[model samples]
Target: MTLDFSWAGEKGCVSLFPNPEFHLENVPAGAKSVSLTLTQGVREMGGEELPLPRNGILPAGTFRTFAPCNPGVYQWTAQAKSATGEVLSEARKARYYPSDEVAEHKP
Candidate 1:
Protein backbone atom coordinates (compact mmCIF):
# COMPACT_ATOMS: atom_id res chain seq x y z
CA MET A 1 0.00 0.00 0.00
CA THR A 2 1.09 3.61 -0.58
CA LEU A 3 -0.01 6.75 1.27
CA ASP A 4 0.29 10.36 0.25
CA PHE A 5 -0.50 13.52 2.15
CA SER A 6 -2.06 16.63 0.68
CA TRP A 7 0.55 18.90 2.21
CA ALA A 8 3.89 18.59 3.99
CA GLY A 9 6.84 20.77 4.91
CA GLU A 10 10.43 20.43 6.04
CA LYS A 11 10.88 17.56 8.47
CA GLY A 12 7.27 16.51 8.04
CA CYS A 13 5.74 19.71 9.32
CA VAL A 14 1.97 19.86 8.69
CA SER A 15 -0.80 22.30 9.39
CA LEU A 16 -2.79 21.65 12.54
CA PHE A 17 -6.12 22.89 11.28
CA PRO A 18 -8.00 21.98 8.12
CA ASN A 19 -6.55 18.53 8.50
CA PRO A 20 -4.67 17.02 5.60
CA GLU A 21 -6.27 14.52 3.25
CA PHE A 22 -4.73 11.03 3.00
CA HIS A 23 -4.61 9.40 -0.40
CA LEU A 24 -4.11 5.65 -0.53
CA GLU A 25 -3.03 3.65 -3.51
CA ASN A 26 -1.47 0.38 -4.65
CA VAL A 27 -3.32 -1.70 -2.10
CA PRO A 28 -2.54 -5.36 -2.39
CA ALA A 29 -5.03 -7.68 -3.96
CA GLY A 30 -7.32 -9.79 -1.72
CA ALA A 31 -7.56 -7.00 0.80
CA LYS A 32 -11.16 -7.09 1.97
CA SER A 33 -11.02 -3.93 4.00
CA VAL A 34 -8.87 -0.96 4.96
CA SER A 35 -8.62 1.42 7.89
CA LEU A 36 -6.71 4.54 8.82
CA THR A 37 -5.79 6.11 12.13
CA LEU A 38 -3.98 9.11 13.53
CA THR A 39 -2.57 9.24 17.02
CA GLN A 40 -0.45 11.34 19.32
CA GLY A 41 1.13 9.32 22.09
CA VAL A 42 -1.72 7.19 23.46
CA ARG A 43 -4.54 9.42 22.25
CA GLU A 44 -6.28 8.60 18.99
CA MET A 45 -7.22 11.69 17.05
CA GLY A 46 -9.30 10.07 14.35
CA GLY A 47 -9.91 6.82 12.50
CA GLU A 48 -12.19 5.08 10.03
CA GLU A 49 -12.61 1.82 8.17
CA LEU A 50 -13.97 0.95 4.75
CA PRO A 51 -14.89 -2.25 3.07
CA LEU A 52 -13.41 -2.74 -0.36
CA PRO A 53 -15.63 -3.04 -3.44
CA ARG A 54 -17.01 -6.34 -4.68
CA ASN A 55 -13.76 -7.17 -6.40
CA GLY A 56 -11.95 -6.81 -3.07
CA ILE A 57 -9.89 -3.99 -4.54
CA LEU A 58 -9.29 -0.56 -3.19
CA PRO A 59 -9.75 2.03 -5.86
CA ALA A 60 -6.93 4.32 -6.81
CA GLY A 61 -6.98 7.77 -5.15
CA THR A 62 -9.06 6.55 -2.22
CA PHE A 63 -8.74 9.15 0.50
CA ARG A 64 -9.81 10.20 3.98
CA THR A 65 -9.47 13.23 6.23
CA PHE A 66 -8.26 12.96 9.81
CA ALA A 67 -8.53 15.76 12.30
CA PRO A 68 -5.52 16.43 14.52
CA CYS A 69 -6.74 18.50 17.44
CA ASN A 70 -3.43 19.70 18.83
CA PRO A 71 -0.10 20.92 17.65
CA GLY A 72 2.41 18.13 18.18
CA VAL A 73 4.00 15.11 16.63
CA TYR A 74 1.62 12.46 15.38
CA GLN A 75 1.76 8.98 13.93
CA TRP A 76 -0.53 8.04 11.07
CA THR A 77 -1.21 4.47 10.08
CA ALA A 78 -3.02 2.67 7.29
CA GLN A 79 -3.84 -1.00 7.44
CA ALA A 80 -5.34 -3.52 5.09
CA LYS A 81 -6.77 -6.86 6.04
CA SER A 82 -7.67 -9.94 4.09
CA ALA A 83 -10.35 -12.55 4.77
CA THR A 84 -7.61 -15.00 5.62
CA GLY A 85 -6.52 -12.84 8.57
CA GLU A 86 -3.40 -11.51 6.90
CA VAL A 87 -2.66 -7.83 7.43
CA LEU A 88 -0.52 -5.19 5.76
CA SER A 89 0.24 -1.84 7.37
CA GLU A 90 2.25 1.31 7.02
CA ALA A 91 3.07 4.14 9.44
CA ARG A 92 4.59 7.57 9.15
CA LYS A 93 5.39 10.38 11.56
CA ALA A 94 4.56 14.02 11.12
CA ARG A 95 4.98 17.20 13.16
CA TYR A 96 1.86 19.40 13.23
CA TYR A 97 2.09 23.11 13.78
CA PRO A 98 -0.77 25.46 14.56
CA SER A 99 -1.76 27.80 11.75
CA ASP A 100 -0.35 30.78 13.61
CA GLU A 101 2.95 29.06 14.13
CA VAL A 102 3.14 28.20 10.45
CA ALA A 103 2.33 31.74 9.46
CA GLU A 104 4.99 33.15 11.74
CA HIS A 105 7.69 31.11 10.08
CA LYS A 106 6.85 32.23 6.59
CA PRO A 107 9.67 33.96 4.63
Candidate 2:
Protein backbone atom coordinates (compact mmCIF):
# COMPACT_ATOMS: atom_id res chain seq x y z
CA MET A 1 0.00 0.00 0.00
CA THR A 2 1.14 3.57 -0.66
CA LEU A 3 1.91 5.43 2.53
CA ASP A 4 1.16 9.17 2.93
CA PHE A 5 4.87 9.90 3.40
CA SER A 6 5.76 13.54 4.17
CA TRP A 7 8.12 15.80 6.11
CA ALA A 8 7.18 17.91 9.11
CA GLY A 9 8.16 21.18 7.48
CA GLU A 10 11.09 23.06 5.98
CA LYS A 11 14.56 22.57 7.42
CA GLY A 12 18.18 21.65 6.84
CA CYS A 13 18.03 18.27 8.53
CA VAL A 14 15.37 15.79 9.56
CA SER A 15 15.12 12.63 11.66
CA LEU A 16 12.98 9.46 11.54
CA PHE A 17 12.00 6.68 13.94
CA PRO A 18 10.50 3.63 12.21
CA ASN A 19 10.58 0.43 14.27
CA PRO A 20 13.46 -1.15 12.40
CA GLU A 21 12.02 -4.47 13.41
CA PHE A 22 9.95 -5.46 10.39
CA HIS A 23 8.83 -4.40 6.92
CA LEU A 24 5.31 -4.63 5.42
CA GLU A 25 3.69 -6.38 8.37
CA ASN A 26 1.00 -7.52 5.96
CA VAL A 27 -2.59 -7.89 7.23
CA PRO A 28 -2.20 -8.91 10.83
CA ALA A 29 -3.37 -12.38 11.87
CA GLY A 30 -7.10 -11.42 11.62
CA ALA A 31 -7.30 -7.94 10.15
CA LYS A 32 -9.75 -7.11 7.34
CA SER A 33 -8.69 -3.50 6.70
CA VAL A 34 -5.46 -1.49 6.85
CA SER A 35 -4.34 2.17 7.10
CA LEU A 36 -1.22 4.33 7.51
CA THR A 37 -0.23 7.75 8.92
CA LEU A 38 2.70 10.03 9.73
CA THR A 39 3.73 12.56 12.41
CA GLN A 40 6.24 15.20 11.35
CA GLY A 41 7.66 18.69 12.09
CA VAL A 42 10.30 21.03 10.76
CA ARG A 43 12.43 24.05 11.79
CA GLU A 44 13.43 25.78 8.59
CA MET A 45 12.12 26.46 5.06
CA GLY A 46 10.58 29.85 5.71
CA GLY A 47 7.03 31.19 4.93
CA GLU A 48 5.83 29.68 8.22
CA GLU A 49 4.35 27.14 5.84
CA LEU A 50 4.96 23.37 5.87
CA PRO A 51 4.93 20.49 3.49
CA LEU A 52 3.01 17.17 3.46
CA PRO A 53 -0.48 16.38 4.66
CA ARG A 54 -1.57 16.27 8.30
CA ASN A 55 -1.67 12.39 8.29
CA GLY A 56 -3.08 9.37 6.42
CA ILE A 57 -2.29 6.10 4.57
CA LEU A 58 -2.72 4.47 1.15
CA PRO A 59 -3.02 1.09 -0.58
CA ALA A 60 0.01 -1.33 -0.70
CA GLY A 61 2.53 0.03 -3.24
CA THR A 62 2.34 3.55 -4.63
CA PHE A 63 3.44 7.20 -4.24
CA ARG A 64 1.18 9.66 -2.42
CA THR A 65 1.46 13.30 -1.34
CA PHE A 66 0.79 14.40 2.18
CA ALA A 67 1.06 18.25 2.36
CA PRO A 68 1.87 20.70 -0.36
CA CYS A 69 4.17 23.68 0.15
CA ASN A 70 7.98 23.59 -0.04
CA PRO A 71 10.70 20.96 -0.16
CA GLY A 72 13.55 20.23 2.18
CA VAL A 73 14.39 18.05 5.18
CA TYR A 74 11.32 16.11 6.38
CA GLN A 75 10.56 13.44 8.98
CA TRP A 76 7.77 10.93 8.43
CA THR A 77 6.35 7.56 9.46
CA ALA A 78 4.50 4.66 7.83
CA GLN A 79 1.75 2.82 9.68
CA ALA A 80 -0.71 0.07 8.80
CA LYS A 81 -3.95 -1.36 10.20
CA SER A 82 -6.17 -4.39 9.70
CA ALA A 83 -9.66 -5.05 8.34
CA THR A 84 -11.03 -5.18 11.86
CA GLY A 85 -9.66 -1.65 12.14
CA GLU A 86 -7.03 -2.79 14.62
CA VAL A 87 -3.56 -1.24 14.68
CA LEU A 88 -1.98 -4.24 13.01
CA SER A 89 1.39 -2.47 12.86
CA GLU A 90 3.28 0.26 14.58
CA ALA A 91 4.43 3.50 12.93
CA ARG A 92 7.92 4.15 11.58
CA LYS A 93 9.94 7.32 10.86
CA ALA A 94 12.52 8.38 8.31
CA ARG A 95 14.33 11.43 6.91
CA TYR A 96 13.30 12.63 3.45
CA TYR A 97 14.93 14.97 0.94
CA PRO A 98 12.29 15.92 -1.58
CA SER A 99 14.50 18.36 -3.45
CA ASP A 100 17.02 21.23 -3.26
CA GLU A 101 15.39 24.57 -3.98
CA VAL A 102 15.41 26.45 -0.73
CA ALA A 103 16.95 29.90 -0.47
CA GLU A 104 20.04 28.29 1.05
CA HIS A 105 20.77 24.81 2.44
CA LYS A 106 23.61 23.67 4.69
CA PRO A 107 23.30 19.91 4.32
Best by lDDT: 1
Clash pairs, model 1 backbone? none
Judged by TM-score, which candidate is best?
1
Give stretches of model 1 more than 4 Å off: 7-19, 53-66, 93-95, 98-107
Tens-digit lDDT track of model 2 for 1-107: 23233323333222322211113433335444433332235432221111222233232223333432344344334334444445555444344454522222122
lDDT of 2 at 89: 55
For all predictions, the C-alpha RMSD in Å is: 8.5, 11.8
| Candidate 1 accuracy as TM-score | 0.54
Worst 10 residues of 1 by lDDT: 98-107
Can you give the lDDT of residue 46 in candidate 1?
67
lDDT string for model 1 (4-52, tens) is: 4533432233333334555567777777776766666676766667675
Q: For model 1, what is the alpha-carbon lDDT of residue 16?
A: 34
Assess the local accuracy of residue 94 in candidate 1 as a C-alpha lDDT between 0 and 100: 48
